[model samples]
Target: MCGVLPIRKFILLFTIAFMFHVSLAQEGEVASLSQNNLQTYIVYVHKPEGLHSMQSESLHRWYQSLLPVTTASTEHQQQRLLYSYRHVVTGFAARLTGEEVKAMEKKEEVLSMGLHPEKGFWKKSNFDKGVIIGVMDTGVLPDHPSFRDEGMSPPPDRWKGRCDFKQTANRTFVCNKKIIGARSFQVYDNLLHSFSAQPVDEIGHGTHTASTAAGNFVRGANLYNNANGTASGVAPHAHFAIYQVCSLDECSSTDVLAGFDAAVEDGVDVISISMTSLNVGQLFEDSIALAAFSAMQRGIFVVCSAGNSGPSSNSAYNAAPWILTVGASTIDRNIIATARLGNGDEFDGESIFPPNSTKRLNSKLFPLVQPGINGQMLSQNCNNGSLKDINVKGKAVFCERGMEVSRLDQGKVVKAAGGAAMLLVNQEQKGFTTYTDPHVLPASHLSSAAGLNIR
Candidate 1:
């Protein structure tokens, strides 16, 4: 007792059901999803237990069934697989950009003489006159008093020129009334891109190094201290130029090579590089090395650091036969101590006997004590006696080496106790060495005797 359905109605119902089934199948095939149109998501499938029983094609089919149709394109599927495999194998979210990795590697190459005796001896020679010391670190600070001259402004002029290599109109030039010439080579976007036109240093390392190499001795300039500083460069008053080859993060081999080429073209006298790297294979094609060789062929001296990994047998860059590799040493003779007091605190010792009621907190004190001043106290305080007596919590702590604990570890303990700054008194053995640790706030080292007097 059913009425006969129309042929057209039956056909329409069949088509609608077929379309719905197709849509469902397509939805199930998408491999991934992305929020931004420009960005693509990558998906990795987990391996099933005892999956060795399955063939490669069977495994791929199993993964494909979990994705949507839109994401089943060969390219997208490949990307997902690669991303997943890499993540699982490495167990890291993302790797450091090439530039950042390179910068860290170069730090080991940039050696400091610290406070070595031979540091002064190098100044006696005129070798730096024709040498070109390329500081491939931070941007140089143009306003630093160390760089100021008579009738010279603190912040110098900025260089003007295009730096993009892909552009035909690109011309690299830097101008500071004193900066005769400059050339920029921006090749790699990840590492070698120049950020500014001014040849000023954004980081202090470049300034310190440049000053160490060729900065003139200014009469009233406060080099390290406000006193009439006289720590002249190895070759002060020498004509020099800068090759801005480094930034805050990384420097590329390509940029370095271009800078070397420019220095060679300019006929630089000597090349000083404060950078090192573990990629020995890159040295052969390294622009710096090529430039060093070309300069050497023309009788230019190439000097570099022996690296900070001291006591280790690894040979640092520029330690090769063709280059001069310098090491670090201690320079300050006396022991020194620096202490910081809380809001209401005072410090007293045999050499430094301030009244207990004296406002020691909120005060920065550095005492340089000599031998025989507080003979017994100095000997007893060699380890942690001086620091232990200071009640350093919410204050500053200064300790000398020779303690049972590592200097770095001791500094950490002081930091944990709410100390502001931790100064390490140099041990008698190394003489003068630079201490650089990213942890434990701003820190410096003083001589042993100086530290005792400060307490």
Candidate 2:
């Protein structure tokens, strides 16, 4: 994590949410849809001033009233309304037909509507005190040392969020003043469920982003004696309200909106999100954009990722003008390792795989083989089942990076195939850029040019 300057002014950052796989309804195109086609649509309504003063139940009722009534069973009607947006916007996400949507649009209170899609450094005294940054991603590990509340003040009295994490027998995830609030919005997804009933970060993404945003100072922070130093977030004193919206596979648009509703209602100072869908539609057609606009209106800042389909023309996502779109870039620091060939040629590379303190690779030379050279499909990617026929026993297997295969998976494949080590070559599109990854075996990620030379 790079050291970021302390946030002197109240600059809010926003994150784009969800990996939307469903096709989106284009603007003014809903009228052509079949009248009976029932799909989830995000409806935005004009919020009357002083609506916040109303009771929560009353607000929910107001949103419920906007939903078209049906003669079906009460349970069926209740299921139509997926989520209500009180904080992020005055709206609701519901299952509506084309005719029903057209009817809703005619209402005077209806402002706009859209389709639903499915998915930093320390500063002690300058530490952003009292600022609450709402993280919308995977759930967090509340017990991480980065979120310790030492020298941190309690959240301000206006904070209405609560910790929803429950203790389990194996581990106890506790929350303090630093990690003020934690909640999960995985109730909408019927296919994939949250790893736990609580808002525990099953994946490390939430913990990583949370720490990077406002983690506390921890000494000797390093991964296997590399990048060793004191680690702290950009704003050590800022409070975090984690809203877990993603499951293992994808983030549901309904669940994400619920999270946004809660985060905005929680009175967070900033909204930071790192997830993005493969496709981002027009401004009004995207739920994230609509919700972000509401957050901006409420004086909250939003920040988002520029997506991973980069190094390609027009590959950037989350390019909305209202939110800050951040892209990945190289920094000065790198984890140095080397890929030395049997031919006495050496290529300096990067890897996070820790070397044994007593062992060195220079003493021995293993046969270097490329799995796909013998004409096996996907062997270059080192995908599972692709190396079954390849005999890489006690040899250093060279693999290509990409093809929707992760670097970790590639190393795992090599390790499983009885390979001694792995040499990961970046695809041509990646050019000179290389990334360090924690592999299951000894591995080095070499740039595209070096990989070509080795080949």
Against the true structure, whose lDDT is highest? Answer: 2
Task: List lDDT for all candidates, in order.
Answer: 0.45, 0.76
Whole-model lDDT for model 1 versus the true structure? 0.45
Tens digit per residue, CA lDDT, model 1, 169-269? 44333333233344444323463443554455556666676666766556655312323345555555443456666655455565666666766666555
Highest-TM-score candidate: 2
TM-score, predicted candidate 2 vs. hidden true structure: 0.64
- The total of clashing pairs for model 2 equals 15
Give the per-residue Cα lDDT of candidate 2 at 398. 90
Candidate no. 1 TM-score: 0.46
lDDT of 2 by residue, 268-375 (tens): 988887776544456665667778889999999887777766578987766889988777556668887788877788998888887673156768888999877767
